[model samples]
Target chain A: DAGVTQSPTHLIKTRGQQVTLRCSPKSGHDTVSWYQQALGQGPQFIFQYYEEEERQRGNFPDRFSGHQFPNYSSELNVNALLLGDSALYLCASSPGGWNEKLFFGSGTQLSVL
Target chain B: DQQVKQNSPSLSVQEGRISILNCDYTNSMFDYFLWYKKYPAEGPTFLISISSIKDKNEDGRFTVFLNKSAKHLSLHIVPSQPGDSAVYFCAATYNTDKLIFGTGTRLQVFP
Candidate 1:
């Protein structure tokens, strides 16, 4: 069975531009979550989508938004990207809603130059 | 404000030695804690976890200890091997859906 898969292994974007990263969860998994890992830091939770709806969110601003499709895949969109937006965007999938072990994808490296 | 904190940025240990990475959180409501390991250019992988009900949980050479009173948790790797070297992150969840992570601790095991 394949693990979580993310698109565009690496990307480069300029300031004021918007970017969308995609994720397909692991087989038999239904929940999807997004995280941001800055250089030399741990992954920070962005939001979680379950049952095709956002179930929980972190302290991120409105510019960071996400959507979950019926098939349990997810997309993370960052608008008006800034230089600080450069980081590794990771997608994780789990079978249940809460306290479930997560399977993570290699992540998409976003570079705002 | 950083709720979860891993003071030590990096740790180095000789092979077959014990390595202990510490983490502390200011949030008392957090009841579930977990540790994840990450290699370069890879996503963080779940290592182990402990609920507030248990003070310790162990899996092979990996163990996680939770001290609720002190709001601290630790991951202990016994007989550390070179392959075990990676960045370790401490995460906590209050309601179990969203997790808050601390700055990771990079572990280097010398052969």
Candidate 2:
């Protein structure tokens, strides 16, 4: 089966510009989660989407938001981007029950200039 | 503050030797712990995991040991190979919430 897939593998934008990254979860997963991986740091949770609604969110600011389609694809939107926003954006999906492991996409590399 | 910490930023070992990576967490509520390995330009790949109910879990040549009382966990890779060299991260979760990850440790296995 095809694993989680993310589009626009790499992106570059100027500060104050908005960016949208897309993700298609694994074949059978229903829950989608987003994470930010800064240089030298591990991935940090941004938020999770289940049933088209944001179920849990991390300490990120309001500038970060996301949407999940009925087909289980997801989009992460970052408004008023800053230089610090330049990082790898990862999209992960789980089976949506008591499953603990997550299938992750290669991630979208966002570069803010 | 970081709830999970991997003090060692890098580790090097000869091939066919054991590689031990350590991780510590400050959150006592964390019950599920996992290890992930990542190559450049790739997302973290799940390696192994352990729950609070068990102190050890093994899968093939990879093993994870959890010390709940000390809030520490470790990953052991036996007879390490050069291809095993990569950045390893430790993560934990409470219930079904978001996973908190450590900084990561880069392991280099030399032949």
Candidate 3:
């Protein structure tokens, strides 16, 4: 069984630009959650998607949004990137319904210059 | 406000010794806690978890202990090995989907 997979292992964007990161969940999983890990910090919750709908969100602003497709894949979009946006964006998936353990992808390293 | 805190930025232990990593959370509402291990360039991998109802949970060489009164949790690795060296994060949730993670502690087991 393939684990969670993310696209564009690395990305570069300038201020005021936008970027999209993609994620494919593990087989048999239905929920996808996004997280941001800044340097010397733990992964911070961004939002979670379930059944093509957002189930919950964290303290992130409106500039950060996500979409979950029927296939269980997800996309995280960040608009008007700032220098602080530079971090490792991680995607994790679970089997849904109060499942606590999450399988995570290697993550995409985003650098806003 | 940082809800979850891992005060130790790094830890070092000799091989075969016990390694203890501590975490504390400010939210008393959190009922579930988990630990994850991450290597460089990789996402954090689930390690073990403990619920508020239980004080301790063990899985093979890894174990998790939670103290509800102190709002603190810890992860213990017995007979630590070099491969076990990685960044460890403790997270908690209040019966909700979103998890509040600590800053993480880098553990190195030297031979």
Candidate 4:
């Protein structure tokens, strides 16, 4: 029973480049959420996906988007990245429908240089 | 506007002592509150949570107390251990599913 898993633990991209991070939800989980954590700050919600569709979104711009596959895995895509985009992108999974506990992955550390 | 806030940037406590981390929210609509613990280079892990219907919730050494009247909440760790040292974040959620997080409080448990 592995918990949420994320790929490309660390990445480096230049300004204006696009990057995609991946996440596999925990077994039996159907909802996936994305968050961004800057250095010395807590995470800010980016969006959430359920039933292969985006159910809720935060105050992020269009440059940040995500998708959830039928297998409950997710991908976060960021386009036209900026230096401020350099942060830890976290993926959390939970059981859909209610206030289930969220299981988080180690996260992908993106450094826009 | 920041809905949730953890004003304390850091807290230091000796081992075997108690640690109390505080949080406040400006939104009265927030119905659920959660606390998460994070270490460097890792994502946050859920530590505890409380719903607005309850004033307090406890699990082992960790306890979360919510004061709806004051729009405040606090996490108390009794007999703190070195492993408890980490950055703590307070998050709130309204009827909508999305969660809003605070700036976080770094806790240092000295042995």
Candidate 5:
């Protein structure tokens, strides 16, 4: 079975520009969550989507947004990128609700210059 | 403030020794805890988890112990191998999809 998949394994964007990262959840998963991992640091939860609606969010600001499609695929959008925004964007998928085993993608590495 | 914390930024152990990684959380309401191991340039991979209801959970050579009273948890690896060396992260959640993570500890197993 196919696991979670992410696109554009690497990206480069300048400040004041917008970037979009895509993710497809693993088979049989119904939820998708986004996380950002800074160098030498653990990942921080960004947001989660279920049923195409954002069910929960973290401490991130309005500059960070996401979307979940009908097929359980997700996209993370960031506006006005900052140097601090340079991190590995991870997409995790779960079977259903919270506390379930999460399947993670390789992640999209974003370099905000 | 970090809800979850891993005090050790890195650790080294001789292969075949018992390696213990510790984690703590400030939130008493966190009901679920998980451990993830990551290799360089790769995403974190789920290792093992412990629910609040259970004090201990074991899988293969790995074990996790949870102490609800202290808001602490630990992961134990027996006869650790060199391949076991990786960055380990502790995560916790309170019945929500959001998981709070620690800074992570890099484990190095030396033969």
Candidate 6:
């Protein structure tokens, strides 16, 4: 009955540093997706992972990368973080494809200084 | 290129009134549209969705109307309650695994 769980509710990082955000999908869910939401903006899709492989990606740059493990857990990594990288990183879980209703985690607030 | 646009940044309505939130998209290929309700610190919750095949879908007091020709969609909430006040996000997908979201509209239902 537990929903998606995220680690390190809030984080602070300096410029040029690499940061990793973790997510554990809800029970019985197998797909994981990553999204970035800047202040006053809606969540933007970064990538989606299914069957332990990336199935689709958005218009994000190379610096933003993700990995899906066998357990349906996922991680989002951002390298050379810039000040603009400070935003809320959200992880969503679905039962199957993109069309399914996505259940989201509270999100990890990343602050890049 | 912002494919999805919610021109109104915010909307306010009185209790027991009807509140409508509008959304438009430029991509004609998008066939699936959805709405999400979000609080200040919480992640968005799925409100409702409509596929290309349907022009309208209703669930309780919330309804979604899709005008395919105009590439526009709207969410209507009746007898608005204060608890319904939150940021509403419009999202679209083209039968793919990715969704394009709009800037979102903040709705405030007053007493």
**Residue-by-residue lDDT tens digits, candidate 3, B1-111:** 999999999999999999999999999999899999999888889999998999999999999999889999999999899999999999998866588899999999999
DockQ per model, Cα = 0.72, 0.71, 0.74, 0.67, 0.70, 0.72
Across residues B18-105, which tens digit of lDDT does each residue of candidate 1 receive?
Answer: 9999999999998889999999888889999998999999999999999989989999999899999999999988877588889999
Task: Identify the superior model by DockQ, candidate 1 or candidate 6.
Answer: 6
The candidate 5 chain B region of ten consecutive residues with least summed lDDT is B92-101
Model 1 Cα displacement at B40 (Å)? 0.5
Question: By how many angstroms RMSD does model 5 differ from the true structure?
Answer: 1.1
Candidate 3 docking band: medium
lDDT of each: 0.92, 0.93, 0.93, 0.92, 0.91, 0.93
**After superposition, candidate 4 runs with Cα above 4 Å error:** none
Q: Where is model 2 more than 4 Å wrong at Cα?
A: A97-99
lDDT of 2 by residue, B14-36 (tens): 99999999999999999899999
Q: Candidate 4 at residue B12, lDDT? A: 100
Worst 10 residues of 3 chain B by lDDT: B92-101
lDDT of 4 by residue, A8-89 (tens): 9999999999999999998999999999988877788898999999888888999999999989899999999999999999
User: Where does candidate 6 chain B have its weakest 10-residue lDDT segment?
Assistant: B92-101
Candidate 1: list runs displaced more than 4 Å: none
Local lDDT at A78 for model 1: 99
DockQ class, candidate 4: medium
Tens-digit lDDT track of model 2 for A5-80? 9989999999999999999988888999999999999999999998888989999999999999999899999999
Per-residue accuracy of model 6 over A72-105 as CA lDDT, tens digit each: 9999999999999999999999987654579999
Scored against the true structure, residue A93 in model 1 reaches a CA lDDT of: 95
Query: Where does the lowest 10-residue lDDT sum fall in candidate 1 chain B?
Result: B92-101
What tens digits encode model 5's per-residue C-alpha lDDT throughout A1-113? 98999998999999989999999998999899999998878899899999999988889999999999999999999999999999999999997755456788999999988
